[model samples]
Target: MLKSFDNKALEELNDSNASENERAKKGLKKRSDFGYAVLFLGPSLLLLGVFVFYPMIKTLYMSLFLTNNFGQTTIFVGLKNYTSLLTSASFLASLSSTFIYVIGVMVLTIVLGLALAVFANQKLKGIQFFRTIFSSTMGVSVSVAAIFFLFVFNPTTGLLNQMAGLLHLPQLNWMTDPNLAMITVIVSTVWMNLGFTFLVLFGALQAVPRSLYDAADIEGASKSYQLFKITIPMISPSLFFVGIVTLIGAFKSFGLIDLMTAGGPNNATNLLVYRIYQDAFLNGNYSQASTESIVLTIIIAVMTIIQFKVLEKRVNY
Candidate 1:
C-alpha cells in the first residue's frame, strides 16, 4: 500500500512538472511574438505619432488660445473662438456649402461610378479599351485635374461656352458666376474621384459569382430585376465602403477648390475646408482656423459614425 501511494505521488508530481514546462514554453513563445511585433510595428507607430497624432494634438491645443499672425498662441482664450465662429455668418454659409458639396460629391460619384463600372463589366468587344479610359482618371493628380478643369470651365475658351456659342445659345459664366461655381466644382470633383469609385465597384462586381445571375435568368427574371436584386446585394459591402471613402474625400477637398474657385463670387463656393485655409493664410486668423479644424474633424467623425451605423446594416458581408 505504501509503495502504491509513493508511485501515485511520483506520477502526479511528474504530470504537474510536465504541465508547467508546457506553460513555460508557451509563455516564452508569446513574449518572442510580442517582441517581433513591436520590432515590425515600431517604425510605423513612430511615424504616425510624429506626423499625424502630434499635429492633431497640436492643432487642438492651439485652438484654445489666441494666436498672432505667425500662428503663435499668446492669450488663453477658452472657447471664445468656438463661440464666435459658431455664430459667424461666414462660418454658417461655409458649413452649409460644405454639406452640399459633400453630399453632391458622395451621391453623384457612387451612382456614376457604378454606372461606369457596369458599362465596363460588359463582355463586348473593345471593352478593355473602355475600361482603361474609365480608370485612367485615377492616375491623374489633383493639381493636373484642377489645371485642366480651369481652362475647360473658363468663360471664353471653355468647351461648354464654345459649344453654347456654336449652338447659338445664351453665353453663361462657368466659374466666375456664383450660381454655377459650386456646381462646376462638384462636377469636376466627381470626375476626379469617379475613377477610384469605378475601380472598386468594378472589382467587386467581378468577384460576384456569375452563378447567381444565371440562376436568376433561368427563373425568367428581367435584367433590371437581376441588377437590383442580384448584383446590388452582392456588391453592397463595396458600395458602403466607397460611400464612406468618397464622403470623407469630399469633406477634405482643398487643392482643387483652391486652384479653381478660390471661394470666389461672393463666397458661394466657400467650403469649410477652404474656409479654414482662408482663415489661416488669407485672413490671418490662426486660432479660429484651428478651432474650425477641430469642428470639421468632429463633424467628419460623427458623419462617419452615422454612415457605419446606418449603411453597414445593408452590407451583405
Candidate 2:
C-alpha cells in the first residue's frame, strides 16, 4: 500500500509538470502571436492617431489660444472662451435646448423602436416586407430627412398643414414657433433613427434561445411574464448598445438642425454641434468654438462611460 501510494503521488507530480509545461508552451506561442497581431494592427492604429487623436489634441490646444482677422493674428487667452460660454445667456439657453433635445429624442426613439421591433417580430404574413418598410428610413440621409420634414411641416403648403386643413384643425407653424421648433427637431430625429434602433432590438429579440421560452411556457408563465422576466434581461445588452448610440447621435446632431431650423426663432433649436459650427464659421470665434467642442466631447465621453458602467452591471452575461 505504501508503494502504491508512492507511485500514485509520482503520477500526480508528473501530470502537474506536464500541465505546467503545456501552459508555458501556450504562453510562449501567445507572446509570439501577439507580435504579429500588433504588426497587423499598426497601420489602423497609426491612421486613428493621425486622423482622430491628433485632431482631437489640436482642437484642445487651439481652444487655449485665439486667432484674429482670419487667422492673421494670434493671441493666447486661456479659459476666457470657456468662461464666456458659461456666462453667456444665449449659450446657456442653447445648452438647455440641446439637453432637452437629447432627452426627448432618446426616450421617444427607444420607446418607439421597441414597439416597432416587437410588432415586427410577430409571425405575421409579409412580416419581412413590413420589417423592410420600417427599416427603409435608415437609408435616408439626415439632410434629406430634415428637408422632408421641413416640407411636411410647412405652415402654408406642407402636407401636415394640408391634412390639418382637410380635418378643419389648426395649422401649426412648426418652424416659426420657438416652442415647437425644438419639438419638431426632436420628432424628425426620432423618425430618422427609429428604424435603426428597431432593427437592433429586433435582432436581439431573435437571438434569444428558443429553449428558454419553451421552458417558460411549460412552467405556465404567461407571454407577458416571460417577456419581462426573460426577454428583457436577455436583450438588455442590445438595449444598452442602442441607448449609447442614440445618445451620442443626439448630442452630435447638427445637419438636421442646420437644414431645418438654422437655429432661428431666437435660437430655439440651437444644439451644441450647431453652436460649434456657428462659432467657428458664422461668428469667427474659433477659440470659443474649440472650447465648446472640447466641452461637448467631454460631456459625451462622461455620459457614455456612465452608461456603460451602469448598464453593464444589469446585463445578464
Candidate 3:
C-alpha cells in the first residue's frame, strides 16, 4: 500500500509538471505570434484612433472653449456653455421636441413592425410575396424616403391633400403646422424603419419552436391567448432588442427632421442631433455644438442603461 501510494503521488506530480510545461509552451507561442497579430490589427487600430478616437477627444476639448465659424478658439468658457444651454428657451424646446419625437418613433415603429411581422409570419398562400413587400422599405435610402414623403405631403399636388379633396375633407398642413409637423415626421420615420423592425421580429418569430404552439393548440388555447402568453414571451428577447435599437435610432434621427421640416415651422421638430448640426455648421457655435454633442452622448448612455435595467428583467431569454 505504501509503495502504491508513493507511485500515485509521483504520477500526480509528473502530470502537474507536464501541464505547466504545456502552458509555458503556449505562452512562448503567443509571444511569437504577437508580431503577426500586430501586423494584422495595426492598420485598423490606426484608422480608428485617427477617425474615431481623435474626433471624440477633440470634441471634448472643444466643448471647453468657444470656437468661431472657422473653428478657431474665441473664448475659454468652461462650464458656461453647458449652463447656458440648460437655460436657453430654444435649447429647452429642442430637448422637449427631441423626447416627443423619440418616444413617438419608438412606440409606433415597434408596434407597427411587430404587427406586420406577425401577419407576415402567417403561413397563408403568397405569404413570401407579402413578406418581401413588407420588408421592401429596408432597401430604400433615408434621403430617398424623405424625398418621396416630401412629394406625398406637398400641399397642392400632394397625395394626402388630393385624397382629402376627393373626400371633401379639409386640407391639412402636414409640414408647416407646429402641432402636426412632429407627428408627420414620426409617421415617416416609423414607415422607413418598419421594414427592419419587421425583419428582426419576423426572424425571431420564425425561430420560435413550433412545438410550443402545438402544445398550446392541443390544450385548446385561443389564438389571442397563445399570442399574448406564448408567442410574446417567446419573442420577448427580440422585442427587447428592437426596443433598444429603435430608442437609439430615434434619438439619432436627423435626416428626416432636416429634409422634412428643417427642424420646423417653429422648431417643433428640432431633435438634438439636428440641433447639433445647426449649432456647428449654420450658427458656427462649435463650442455649444460640442457641448450639446456631449450632452446627447450622456443622454443616450443614461437612457440606454435605464432601458436595460428596466426591460432586461422582462426578456424571457
Candidate 4:
C-alpha cells in the first residue's frame, strides 16, 4: 500500500513539473518580445550615451590636466585646480555674488508667483486675459528679455528713466551700477520665470478638493484660516517643486548676466556659471573651468538632496 501511495505522489509531482515547464516557455516568449522592444530603443540610448555621458566623462578628464598651446598634456596635477579655485579672491567674490543672486531670484519669483496665482484664481472678469498677459513673459527668450530690459532701463533715453524724470525722481543707473546691475538681473529673471511658477501653483490650487473647503465653512473656519490650514498644505508639493526649479535656474543663469552686465562692475555681478564661461572660452583655462564646473555640480546636487530630505518631508502629499 505504501509503495502504491509513493508512486501516486510522484505522478502528481510530474504533472506539476509539466505545468511549470509550459509557464517557463511562455515567459521565454515574453522575454523575447521585451528584447525586441529594447532593440527599438537602441538608437535613442546610443545617442544619449554618446552625446551626454561621453562628453561628461571627457570634461571630467579634461579637468585634471594642464593644456598649453603646444599640445594636450596630462600632467595629473591632482587637486591644484581645486585649490586655486578655492583660494582665489575673485572666485570667492563670485561665489558670494552667486549666493546673493540665487536667494534674490528665488524669493522674488516665489512671492510674485504666489501672488499672481492667487489673484488669477479669483473669480474676476477677463481673468483669462490677465493670465495670458502675466504668462506671456515665459515665451520670451532670455536673450530677448535681456536686450529688451537693457533698452527699457537705459539711463539716457529709457522708458524707466523718462518716467522717473516725469515724476521728479532721481534718474538711476539701472544696469551700469554694480549694486543696481545685479538687482536688475534678479528682477528680470523673476519676471521671466514667474509665469511657469504661477501656472504650477494655480493648477495645484485648482486641484484641491472642494469638499475640504465646504467642510471648513461648515466648521465655522474663516477663509484666511482655511487657506493657511488647508490650501497651503495641499499646495505645498507644488511650491516645493517651484522652489527647486527656481533655485536651479537662478544658479545656472548666464544669458541675462552675459547680455546685460557681462558680470561687470569689477566682478560684482559675476556668478559662478558666468565665471566658468569666462574661464573656459575667454581665458582658455579649461582645467580651472572644469574644476569650477565640478564644484558647482556638487553644490547643486547637495541642494537637491537637501530639498528632498528636508523640505519635501513637510509636503502634505
| lDDT to native, each model | 0.86, 0.84, 0.85, 0.82
The order of the candidates by TM-score, greatest first, is 3, 1, 4, 2
Tens digit per residue, CA lDDT, model 2, 1-317: 01123334555688998987898988754245677878999899999999999989888888888877473327877888778879999889988999999999999998889888878887788999999988888899998898899999888999988999999998888889998898899999999998899888999889988889889989999988987898778888777778778888899999998899998778899899999999889988888888899989999878766665655355565
The alpha-carbon deviation from the true structure for residue 103 of candidate 3, after best TM-score superposition, in angstroms, is 0.6
Best by TM-score: 3
Among these predictions, the greatest lDDT belongs to 1
RMSD of 1: 12.0
Pairs that clash in candidate 4: none
- TM-scores of the models, in the given order? 0.86, 0.83, 0.87, 0.84
lDDT of 3 by residue, 1-317 (tens): 01123334555789998987898988754245678879999999999999989988898889889888898877888888889989999999999899898889989988899899888988899999999999999899889999999888888888999999999999999888988888889989999988888998999899989899899899999989988988788888778778777888888999988889999888899899999999999998899999999989888777666555545354555
On residues 25-104, what C-alpha lDDT tens digit does candidate 1 reach at each position?
A: 88754245678889999999999999989989999989999999999989999888889989999899999998999999
Which candidate, 1 or 2, has the higher lDDT? 1
Reference-based lDDT, residue 29, model 4: 47
